[model samples]
Target: MKDCEFFFESKENVEQDGRVILDEYRTHLKDKNTREDINDNELLEKCINIVFEHMKYNRVYIYGIGSSSVVAREFKLRFMRLGLDVDYLAESHSIRMNITRVNQESLVIGISVSGKTEEVIEGLREAKEKGAKTIMLSAARVYEYRSYYDELILIGGLKNLAISDKISPQVPALIVVDILYSHYLNYNNDNKKEKLQMTLEHINYELEE
Candidate 1:
């Protein structure tokens, strides 16, 4: 009961497996619901513009580890479907060895739930040194490595449900993706509709075949 107490924020809530899951769902819902409340539109717009800027001259590179890597690949694919060929760096050397090729035209997105994953942070440092615009996506409200990123996107606000049984980092990271991606379409829906449709059609075809 000591471990489960945090989930029952109010005395009115009782502890059952159903309650445990519903409470967990509420926490997730709280996080997802707050996505719009954070007023990140300005940053979202700035990110899209940075992405758009690179879409023309340079390419987008995604760097992450563990759960962040999953989000990185997903984001890369989402942008790629929009006709922007993106790079998701899965190896340590691939990011560092290629740092020489990164510049202002290049964009490196570093995703770290703790905002303190040393590998992601250090890679972003080198990328920045090479003049690449860097974006840090994390769940932390405040952290020490804030200085390394050109733009900070804090998505999952739920702070300390750190146990393995609890929901994890990738949940909110995807919500950020959903937020940024939905807005991207809204920003240019007229131009993007055909591409979106084509992608859906292709996916449907692949599934059918």
Candidate 2:
């Protein structure tokens, strides 16, 4: 048996069908989870103020590649649902051309899992130069390009598993976006209590099912 297989489980070859959804909650429970060192309230408040600041721009540009792109688009739709102008860039030139068009009143949210993706890093630099405010969503430990952003939202700790299968990374990214959605709602909506209650209901439903 391969070392990875031996290290994880025998069920992988027998029953898992080579697909595993990395159970994020289980991963967290494996360790004594700690809240991120950064102030949660401050991050949420800043994101809200930033959103309000660009309310008139009617265009929020989001750029990310691979799995990050999926997360970015999720946020775009969430914001759009809240009546904000949001766009997700899909192609290379579409993003490059739009960079010149972005204004000081616009916001560009860049998502990079590693915090070092060349395209994402370079894109944020271009957006910043165009006078658009930038926010980075990453769990990156250190990045020299950090100085260019107006806000940094850390998603919490990351875990690497030795399971010998292709587990979907997209789900975890989606969960982080959901967390960000909560922060946005907390900061902006006057009906914050109602919104929080709804979210709690959703979580409970998921747990029960």
Candidate 3:
């Protein structure tokens, strides 16, 4: 048997090991300093306010590559259900091509955990030059690229685990998305709730069909 066989030697041991892994994951998720940093900086509020300000009168584009692209897609879907005109592009070529569609009445959001995704940065740069408002979500503070975006939202919860490839790179971004979705749902409680319900029902109908 291998040296690590003890973990899977029995069903009970496997369950125990699973629980331990889950516990560790929960610990990482509950990072108090990360939560406090977001709260103190009021970045979540700013993100929500930005969405609210733009969703009404402008088109929104979210750009990301690799894992960050998944979070960008999720954000687009969530905001879509809330009746916002939002879309996401994950491919480098597509992002570059889409820059032309961005204009003064546009809000462009870029996601990059490393804070140095060339494609995302370039996309945001072009969008900004076209007079679109830009927001960059990152875990690292890339001050050099500060001029490229209007808002820089730093996401920190899983710490270096994401950078070290120990966990999903999108976890921190997903947490921010969930918080933003919740605030958006509560913004115009009744109207947004109705929109959400309508979307859910439409999805369910399509699934059943």
Candidate 3 minimal-lDDT segment of 10 residues: 157-166
How many residue pairs in model 1 have overlapping backbones?
A: 0
What TM-score, over all chains together, does every model reach?
0.79, 0.71, 0.84
RMSD of each: 6.5, 7.0, 3.9
Candidate 3: tens digits of C-alpha lDDT, residues 1-209? 67457645676977886897677667766778666644543676777778888878878999999999999999999999989999999999999999888999899999998887899999999998999999998887778998899888877746564465456778768887887788888875658877887898987844344
**Model 3 segments beyond 4 Å from truth?**
1-20, 157-164, 205-209
In model 3, pairs of residues that clash are none
* Candidate 2 stretches greater than 4 Å from native: 1-24, 29-34, 37-39, 159-167, 190-209
Between candidates 1 and 3, which one is better according to lDDT? 3
> Pick by TM-score: which candidate is best?
3
lDDT of each: 0.75, 0.67, 0.83
Order of candidates by TM-score, top first?
Answer: 3, 1, 2
